[model samples]
Target: MKKESKTDWPRINAMRDEDIDLSESPELNETFFKDAVVWPAQKKQITLRLDPDVLDFFKSQGKGYQTAINKVLRRYVEAQKHH
Candidate 1:
């Protein structure tokens, strides 16, 4: 799966000088990484392949066509996936 961690790089770099040794503390590591995990905003980009008809239909919707396509696809995935 393709995934990304959302990190505030400047903040992380700043912490490097803060006299706290992250490697020495599991809790610190968890907390640091946890803060960097993003609940993706609707702004994130996703990449997927689609049949020509499906792509053309969404593209015909004008602006924000990708969002519409994703909405349709997200519902489809949620409905079909098995736990």
Candidate 2:
């Protein structure tokens, strides 16, 4: 069963930029972007069957469920390589 969110999203969306506090937030400068590394991971498409409950568990995580599933499988593959 899908759970309902108790968050007041509409009210939060209506808030102005100035109304939000950012005093503790760090400012990202050119140095930060310069040090950033990008990984262009290639993906291949394939059909895979999963149990209803297993599929539902991933789907319940909201958006990017397929990507989340891929991450889990990727970790499993990496762990097996170490054995």
Candidate 3:
């Protein structure tokens, strides 16, 4: 069974822009935008096949299994470069 949300969505949706308080928030200035640098991750998506047992072992460790696999692969590649 799905759990019910406790939030009052109707009341939140009915609120006007002026009704929200922004006193505690910081104001963004031109200097902030000018100094900002954009660094994008050049990741490519691909489908890979793994043996069931190997896949299960990574999944058993819980979240970030793909990242863990990537780290292992990266270390292997680095070792190969040194050889």
Per model, how many backbone clashes are there? 0, 0, 0
lDDT of 3 at 82: 77
Best by lDDT: 2
CA-lDDT, candidates in order: 0.74, 0.88, 0.85
Across 1-83, the per-residue lDDT of candidate 1 in tens digits comes to 27676887677777745666668655656768866535456566667888999889889989999879767867687678743
- Model 2 score (lDDT): 0.88
User: What residue pairs are clashing in model 3?
Assistant: none
lDDT winner between candidates 2 and 3 = 2
lDDT for position 78 in model 2: 65
- The candidate that achieves the highest TM-score relative to the unseen native structure: 2
Distance from true location, Cα of 27 in model 2, Å = 16
- The runs of at least 3 residues in candidate 2 whose Cα sits more than 4 Å from the true structure, single-residue gaps closed, are 1-41
Candidate ordering by TM-score (highest first)? 2, 3, 1
Positional deviation of 59 in candidate 2, in angstroms? 0.3
Better of 1 and 3 by lDDT: 3
**Stretches > 4 Å off in candidate 3:** 1-41
